[model samples]
Target: MASGISDAQLAVFVLSLRRSNPPSDTSIVLFMDSVSPRAREIMEAHAVEGVVFDKSKFGDIHPSTYRWPMITEAVEGRGAAVGNVLVADIRDMAFQGDPFEVIGREGGGLHVFTGVEHITLGKDGWNGGWVRDCFGERLLESIKDEVIICSGVSVGDRDNMVGYLKMMSSEMDLPSFKQCERNGVDQGVHNVLVHTGRLKGGGVDVKVHRQGGGTVANMQAGVAKYRRGEGVVNGEGRMVDVVHQYDRDGELQDHLFREFVEWDMAVEGVGEGGCEGYIIKENTEAYKGICDLSHDPGSDYLECCKVCNGKPNCRGFTHIRKGCWLKTCGNNGNKELKVVGATGAWKV
Candidate 1:
């Protein structure tokens, strides 16, 4: 499950998962601050299940504080219905294959993945500097070189996963966590807990999956390592099942989205039929006046189509030189002002 995901991000994430995994094999649960109309539209369009949680319930604390509670809810709510659970970030993430299969092979009790080690310590990384400032230099020096744990993707058996979340929730109340607030507390506290062997005592059997031969991969080092068509591979040259933190690199993020998500959406005729339960008027003029959605004069017609398709109430769009306008009232807004050089099309 994920939280605070925007409409566009949710669209790609849900669509990509559907393309990669069949409904019989997997179920998706999304946790968000609140579901907006657009979010509801996307969820309905993609058939994704969503759960709402109020971030304000946690009181004056870091936003990441909600992660533990949301994850715990998912784990306990599902109960024994699902044998395993994967709590992951929705943004900048895509599934190339069935994540459950990977988790099954990993032999999970409680599995966590390691991110880039270079930035885990020293003054170079913000997390490192924050750790020193919060916990003091003494604690920082003790585990400065240890590999930082990424809280993005985690997997385990239902009971063990719930146990881990319970432990993490309790840790958030510690006094030291106050100093680490607003920083990367999720990762910092998680790493500290694991490094100190605190989770082991809870029967978590914490298994750390490093860079290679792991189900989930963290692309914190940038996009140089991932080839265009071969997918993201680890040191062992095996394709990673789930990729996280890809947004760190804009170019790579776009590349992956286009390959894994956009292509499938286009092929599957998603939003190709204009508004749902409405007839679209093609090659018509929006003489009533145009409502420009994008000001980019050089925007492509296909892009305009996509923008209109994503909007739930959009009935049609008019494309002109470097401008795109989406109409909500269908073909009855106004017939007075004639728009010159605008070609209108329905989102089929």
Candidate 2:
């Protein structure tokens, strides 16, 4: 759930949450940015009954939405409020474990917690290379799952949420900079204020969970990157989560799927969490080489940009491990908007 959750997947996610038997903390507020009418419809359908619709004051928009300067715009507010809250992805589908059981109250301020994707297996270690390059090896331990902590599943208390948002929004110059759930992204953003040495003196342990997604569905065959230490692929020789494009009624659209199927076949089937194109963030590296990269050097990847540096993709990546998967745009190459599957089938 850290990196993906599509409109189709989100529908199932909301329905599933509503269907969970034991029921979870009523305080959990599902927050997301809406773009098109279709996306909003999906949200309204999945929303809990009786909960009044309140636009996220921060006004978060999807990465595709042109209003933002940052890839993820929702982590701007978190430390002002004091109520318990959970922020999960739309595809985080099932809620097997009771969140209240996992989230307990701590010292003076609340301590939000979340599971960080393992550097090689879970989180995108390579993209975080800039942090390492900027901060060095010691940062590897202290700031280990920094990005994923900000991007993945999270739990927060109001005070910490708002206070943290104030710091990030102001310090980072986030837009509008309002205090709302939209600012509640994963990264233990309040780490410095809440989890620092002062809290440790009180024996507070605000740390990353290190494991995401529970056992059942997570154990499915096609989900793992490798089976018995070997590469994984479906019976059709296509990778897991193939982007098959189709019409509204679910008809195959081979032309759209061609690019990805071509890219997949070309790359010997991209690794785990493969994508037909970037979500403006390119190549679901989670499926491919997205290993415990943050933990080990091998878990890393590099970006190669040249245009901005006056070269194009070759301009110079500046050593950051972020870039969208290249697209064939007018022979020059650009990131695409949507990923149409190889055979024009339903993506969901």
Candidate 3:
């Protein structure tokens, strides 16, 4: 689920999912507040099949908290028609492989991914505060040392996920939960339920996967091993199925952005019109620049493209090797030179 995401964010996610080779029968249900026309068009162009866009709103409750309830209702409505269900964050998420590949065989349980090996509820400031505010300091103290169970991504059987989502939804309605303004209180609730054995009491089996050893990787919590073409990989060096919180790492983020951009560009009209108001040219370099802008130290063309796109009066940028030069056309001086091993883009 997503809210207030840009076209590029939406494009990267759906496009990555489509590229990951999900089963032919798999369906994608997007519970989002809004999606621009350009974003929808990008999804269609990528041949993202069996997608249902749900725009349901839960008054006053933040999307992060309300998504559980929404997912609960959706799962219950589907009955036993679907197999496994994955609840994931959108904007910062990308797929390297089929997410359902491992879950399909696991069967009838909630699969939770933990954060960095040693980081716990009390140690991580954001999560610690959320748990304290929404649940209480006592609850936080109870499982303070336990490895944090992240709610950013989760997988389970249809029935089990429904039960889990129902519990999360019911908890969100509590006075303490409603009074809390924090966006990710759901993660606190999630960790509480998993560590406290609440789901087991409710007849749901919970399986916890450790960071760097699981199918899902949280780039923000741990030092994730990232490859240019493979994305994030586990200890075995195989590409992980889902990469969450990827935006936390600048280099990884740029790599994935360029990968998605390259992929989008391959699909004819997708690159031209999907992101909107910008044209991307492969193997092309900007001839002249008004000024040069440095990236995040080690960043490449992707960061350069991003910088130029966001900067006002930055008509274009030329990427060469490890550097990118921002350009401004003076009397139409911004020319596209066909330079190999480079990319140029400009906002019209």
Candidate 4:
């Protein structure tokens, strides 16, 4: 379910799930292109099972391209087994309760949830506007007022989930989606399929879960409604089963993560490392940068470190051929050295 090195956010996500659900009732399956040493260590520490895939199958396509195919492979490889399948974004997520329990309460049908954004199509939202432009005026005019669907969190029974992912993968190759061949297309196609009832065409029952109203709470646009408590509660004051896109709000994200860290320490007697006044030395090949997680470039090493330092959970940064890559220390802030062509530094 993750593609790269394990970070602090990923640790928080898995740990939250472990804390919320007992292993006897839940199992964690991780799918990755390749597991890094740090990621492997965390997986061993948490007893998470991993499935590795050959990256060449998808080529050097967008990260969104891997989403559906991976899900399809995982579900189908299990013989289309009967169980609730939750496809979630690992980074920037934390669990307050058992997700399967919430889904069970929803009567055990197909459900897709979206993170709410403040801006809408043809307005100030750049991504939404691009989607509108790609589909043209006529198509957008029909659903101009519809809420944007987020592809981050999706859940359904095994058969339905596999069917949904297969549909999405097929739709991505269509001529109509040619112009939409960029990032966020997965979400665009998801919205189109659900809003237009394409899933129904395949005899799949689907329901749209909106932010602040569903078992899963998307904080992308509803950060104000998130208060620091035992768990995140929606506007109606009900505890949400799953929370997504919290990293969009730095203050709230930091608070929630710190809360989890405190809880982990108090309950499990575990301690975490801190990064303060640390700098990654230049020409260090071990911590070579793999990829840039930033949306933009042009940040120098000092600037990148400062940005990472200012962030609540950021522990280190990798400056490489591409750009700056920020990292979290997870349980241990100590930077793991591996041969690469980038420099890594840490700060608290």
TM-scores of all predicted structures:
0.68, 0.39, 0.72, 0.71
Q: Which ten residues in a row have the lowest lDDT in candidate 1?
A: 262-271
Worst 10 residues of 4 by lDDT: 263-272
Task: Give the higher-TM-score candidate: 1 or 2.
Answer: 1
lDDT of 1 by residue, 1-348 (tens): 455665556765777677777566667888777787877877776677887777787677756765677667677877778777777788667766666665568676888988875565554466676666666788778878787778878877787788888888787767876766773667766776677678898788898988766767788843225767676776677777777876654445556545543322211123333334333333234533355443333275566666776767766666666666677645453442222234555543
- Report the lDDT tens digits of candidate 3 across residue range 237-311: 767888888766556765666666543431111123323555566655555334545333215655665666666
Give a tens-digit lDDT track for model 4, residues 239-336. Answer: 88888876655445656556544222111111123334664554332222332334224245656655665677665666656566676552243433
Local error of candidate 3 at residue 49 (angstroms): 8.5
lDDT of 2 by residue, 129-167 (tens): 433333345644565544343333344454443344344
Cα shift from native, residue 287, model 4 (Å): 27
Compare candidates 1 and 3 on lDDT and give the better one: 3
Q: Give the runs in model 1 whose Cα sits over 4 Å from its true position.
A: 57-59, 119-124, 133-136, 222-224, 259-348
Indicate whether candidate 1 or candidate 2 has the larger lDDT: 1
Q: What lDDT score is found at residue 268 in candidate 1? A: 15
